[model samples]
Target: MNSEVILTCAVTGAGDTVGKNPNVPVTPKQIADDCIAAAKAGASVAHIHVRDPATGGVSHDPAHFREVMDRVRDSGVDIVMNITAGGGGDWIPDPADPTRGGPGTDIQTPAERHHPVGELLPELCTLDCGSLNFGDMVYVNPADWLREHARLVQAAGVKPELECFDLGHVWFARQLQQEGLIDADPLYQLCLGIPWGAEADTETMLAMRNKLPASAQWAAFGIGRQQMPMVAQSVLLGGHARVGLEDNLYLRKGVLASNAQLVEHAASLIENLGARVMTPARTRDHLELRGAQTGGEA
Candidate 1:
């Protein structure tokens, strides 16, 4: 078992979860505050996604992202910020005309998806390696788009957390590394338990883990009720863990959990299994991440 682990808290995600859980942060202020609290509760990283405060819907607005980042940075917290570059890929086909997009469909060019990360210059940003049937819609991350996204993240001098939703994604991520699109020691996030993707189970996790490069650093997270189980499983398999409101909303069957509570609980599980969670400084050193930046500059 790995003795030291890095715990990442996905403070807010681009999901329809705001109405489901009152604790899900909607506004920029709430997201920033929750991220700060997660840091204090032993999370080394905070994965962020902005939302429309009024509608509680996903947003790719740079203004919202800037406010959240500014608040977190000004708060004197040392959490490693990881912004999502996997936005604007949702495609819901119109029932009447499959050729056209549905009302909720939001497809964007690689440039549009990379805008926030390119502008914010956070320590890390996600590079979703491949596309898959994401729930009811098709989350489109074509090979060309992924290559462009990887190049953008590389140019920004920000580490790309290659998010692999399936085994094929892991293979594509390795291909990106081989193409030299990703510069640093490649980091991967094995996203399991999502609908139409890899299931949240030991065999699936191990299968994906076995596909990683020898020098690659990786983490795993499961959605909903399997979140905690995947945490323990990932740690046992010599990988890092991620927990927060993004993937799981409840601490228990009927209990709605805050971001801090989720991080704290995950930390406890890590410690209980004879492992310790890494701090932000130690995580940065462990992953060889560059120092965080305020504005978007190389």
Candidate 2:
């Protein structure tokens, strides 16, 4: 069991969850406030995704990101900022014309997807390792696109959290490392329990964990009801954990939870399991994220 664990809270994801849970932060102010609260509740990092305040839909607007960063930095909370670089990859085919994109499709080039990260320069940013059928939509992150994304993240001096949703993603991550596209001693996030991806069972987590590079640092999270279970499972298997409204909305069945509440609950579980949650300073040292104490740009 890993005694020193880094708990990351994915504050607001790009999902159709705002209407589902009232606690999901919509505006920049709300997202920044919850991130601060998550830090106070023992989260070492905050994984952020911006949304259109007017419509509560996912957005890649740099203005949204800038405002959120300004608020979080000005709040004086010492939390590692992890921005999502995995947006603009959603593709839903049209029923009438399968060759063209559907109404929900929002695909983007590597440059467009990397804009926020490149402009803002957060401590960490996500680089999804491969493509997979995410729910009913195809979440495309081809190997060539991934290489370009990795290079961009590397050039920005930010650590790329390789988000692997399946075993093949893990394999491709190793390939990226071999090709020297990834600069740091690779950091990974095992994203499990999403529809048609890896399962959220203990055996599956173990199988994926076993494939990680010997020197790599990794974390794991499950979606919906399996969130807390995977937190415990990840800790037991010597990996870090993630929790927030992004993956699971309810603190328990029938109880809608805020992002801070989820972090608190995950911290409690970590401590109860004979492990401890790492603070922001310790997490930065552990992950080797350079200049983390300096904070992000406004």
Q: Tell me the tens digit of each residue's lDDT in model 1 across 139-169.
A: 9999998998888889999999999999999
Relative to the true structure, how large is the alpha-carbon lDDT of every model?
A: 0.93, 0.93
**lDDT for model 1:** 0.93
Kindly list the per-residue Cα lDDT of model 2 for residues 1-298, writing each as its tens digit. 9999999999999999999999999999999999999999999999999999999998999999999999989989989999999999999999999888899999999999999999999989999999999999899998898898888888899999999999999999999999988886899999999999999999999999999999999999999999999999999999999999999999999999999999999999999999999888888877778764544321
Q: Which stretches of model 1 miss by more than 4 angstroms? A: 292-298
User: TM-score for all predictions?
Assistant: 0.97, 0.97
Deviation in Å, model 2, residue 235 alpha carbon: 0.3
Q: What is the lDDT of residue 113 in candidate 2?
A: 96
Q: Give the least accurate 10-residue stretch of model 2, judged by summed lDDT.
A: 289-298
Instruction: After superposing candidate 2 on the true structure, give the runs of residues whose Cα lies further than 4 Å from its correct spot.
Output: 292-298
